[model samples]
Target chain A: SAVISQKPSRDICQRGTSLTIQCQVDSQVTMMFWYRQQPGQSLTLIATANQGSEATYESGFVIDKFPISRPNLTFSTLTVSNMSPEDSSIYLCSVEQTGGNNEQFFGPGTRLTVL
Target chain B: LAKTTQPISMDSYEGQEVNITCSHNNIATNDYITWYQQFPSQGPRFIIQGYKTKVTNEVASLFIPADRKSSTLSLPRVSLSDTAVYYCLVGGPPGAGSYQLTFGKGTKLSVIP
Candidate 1:
């Protein structure tokens, strides 16, 4: 298991502002992913942050709205651009191990509430 | 990606065993069943994983039948702390290259004292 941490554990932001969440893993990993959990709902994949490449955004999510950066194996960032009340949700980061079960480890999550 | 179906909620008393079943009719041969637990305001925690038969860890046990279309996650004993949402996901290992997890509406377990 990897120790994962996210910055800005909880924050309140005004509408139209952007918030960038940082995810840091204690060890190197192959794949990093970003997920969003709406209030009282299941998680939705925002994108998969690929090293040295652009992030793969899921359907209904676009790069311009939620840009992601994965510069190296152990770190990644997701920026919610031009936020709105609908964008208020818990953003989480997870890393996939290389071999065996390849179980993913998750960060605590960044809870953002856009006012 | 194989979609999963699970109960929306379950109720159990403390000290009693609990079993949650998940169904994935189109599960691929290489696909594995994984279970996760999530508390309020926290990330999901991996409980167990199995390709077939039974797999047990310190946290929970996964029972997969011969057809591999369904799985059961059995908790030996329940506690109030176990009151949370449980998720069932189906996918192959990272080697599959997708490396993405799809979370359904997990079963909410409420352990009463």
Candidate 2:
């Protein structure tokens, strides 16, 4: 089991503004992913953070809206730009452990509320 | 990626064994079946994973048939605290660069006293 943590456990931000969430892992991981969960909805993959390269965004997500950075293996950041009420959701960071199965471990999650 | 199908919700009594089945008819040969449990306002936690036959862990057991088209997650003697949304994912193991995990609606397991 990997120990994961996220900054700003819960935050209330104004609309049209932006918020950057941070994810930290105790051990180095091969791949890091960001997810968004709207109210009463399942988790949606936002992007895959690649170390030393550009992140891979999902189909519905775009780089202009959600930019990801993974400078190292243990840390990554996700920025939600031009936030709106629809963007109020739980954002999570997940990592696929080395030498482990396809199981992905997730952080505690950052709750973002846009007003 | 193989699309998964599962019940939207399931009701069970305390101390009863609950089995939630997930169907993935288009699963690939290299794809493995995995389950995760998620409580409200938290991240999903890995429960079990299996390729074929049955795999058991301290938390739960995964049962996959030889065809690999479907799998079952059995929770024995569930308690109220065990109520959560259970997710079934079918994908290959890591080391393939980036494999996005697509989660379905998931089965919301409710344990009633």
Candidate 3:
């Protein structure tokens, strides 16, 4: 298991502004992903942070709004651009180590409240 | 698209066993079933993973039937700490393609005294 941490554990931002969440893994990871969990709702996969390239986003999410960067194996960032009240959710980053069968280890989520 | 289905909630007494079932009708050949436990204000934690038959760990046991369309997560000797949400995840093994996981609405287990 890897030790994963997210910066700015909770934040309140104004609508139309942007906030960037950072995820740092203790060791190198094979796959890094960002997820969103709304109030009283299940998690939704936002994008897969691919190292040295653009992130692969899931449907209903776009790169223009949620731009991600994975510079190396142990670090990544997800920036929520032009935030809105609807974007107020808990954002989490997870890592699946190499040779594992998708038993992902997740970071303590960043709670974003857009006012 | 979510790939698994589970119950909405359950209630069990302390010291009793609780079994939560999940259904994956369109599970692919390479897909595996994994269970996760989530507490309030915390991220989901890996509980168990099974491809077929049964898989057991210190925390819980997973029972997968022959058809592989459904699986059961058995928690022996429930406690107040076990009161949380449990998710059933199904996805292909880590590989070049088909590695991302899709989560469904998990079952919320409430433990009674």
Candidate 4:
């Protein structure tokens, strides 16, 4: 198990503003991912943050809206750009262990509310 | 990714064993069955994973038959704190671009006293 932490546990932001959420892991991990959970909905994969390269965004999500940066193995950031009211959701950062079989450790999450 | 089907909710009493079955009719040969538990406003926690037969840990047990079409997650001696949403996922491990974990609505298990 990995101990993961995220900054800005909860935040309130105005529409059209941008917020970057930080995710820090206790140890180095191979792959990091970002997800979104809307109100009363299941979790959706936002992107895969790859080290030393551009993040891979899932369908229905684009880099312009949600840009991610993974500078190192233990840390990454996801910036919700040009936020809107519908962008209010819980953002989570997760890491998959090198040898683990489909197991992922998640951060506490950043709860963002756009007004 | 294989699609998973699970019940929307389940009701159980404390100290009773709860079994939640997930059906993945299109499960591939290389795909594995995994379970996760999520609390309110928290990330999902990995419960167990198994390819076939039975796999048990301190927290729960995963039972997969030979057919590989379905699997069961057995929580022994449930408690009130066990009330949460349990998600069942069917996919291969990381490295195969199986990073996207498709989450179903999940079975909301309420352990009543």
Give me the TM-scores for chain A across all models, comma-separated: 0.97, 0.97, 0.98, 0.97
Q: Candidate 3, A105: how far from true, in Å?
A: 0.5
Docking quality class, candidate 3: medium
Give the per-residue lDDT of model 1 (tens digit) for A1-115. 8999999999999999999999999999878999999988898999988799999889999999999999899999999999999998999999887774757889999999999
Number of residue pairs clashing in candidate 4, backbone atoms closer than 3 angstroms, sequence gap of 3 or more or interchain: 0
Ranking by DockQ: 3, 1, 2, 4
Candidate 1 chain A weakest lDDT stretch, 10 residues: A95-104
Query: Residue B88 CA error for candidate 1 (Å)?
Result: 0.5
What value does the lDDT take at residue A57 in candidate 4? 88
lDDT of 3 by residue, A1-115 (tens): 8999998899999999999999999999857999999988899999998787788999999999999989999999999999999999999999988776777899999999999
DockQ by candidate, in order: 0.68, 0.67, 0.68, 0.62
User: Considering every candidate listed, which one attains the maximal lDDT?
Assistant: 2
Q: Model 1, residue A32: displacement in angstroms?
A: 0.4
The parts of candidate 3 lying over 4 Å away from their true place are B94-97
Complex DockQ, candidate 2: 0.67
* Ten residues in sequence with the least summed lDDT for candidate 4 chain A: A97-106
lDDT of 4 at A7: 93
Docking class of 1: medium
lDDT: worst 10-residue window of model 1 chain B? B92-101
Ten residues in a row with the worst lDDT in model 3 chain A? A95-104
Backbone clashes, each candidate: 0, 0, 0, 0
Summed over model 3, clashes come to 0
Chain A TM-score of candidate 3 vs. true chain A: 0.98
lDDT of 4 by residue, A48-104 (tens): 987998898889999999988899999999999999999999999999887778788
Model 2 misplaced regions, further than 4 Å: B94-100
Inter-residue clash pairs, candidate 1: none
Candidate 1: global Cα-lDDT?
Answer: 0.91
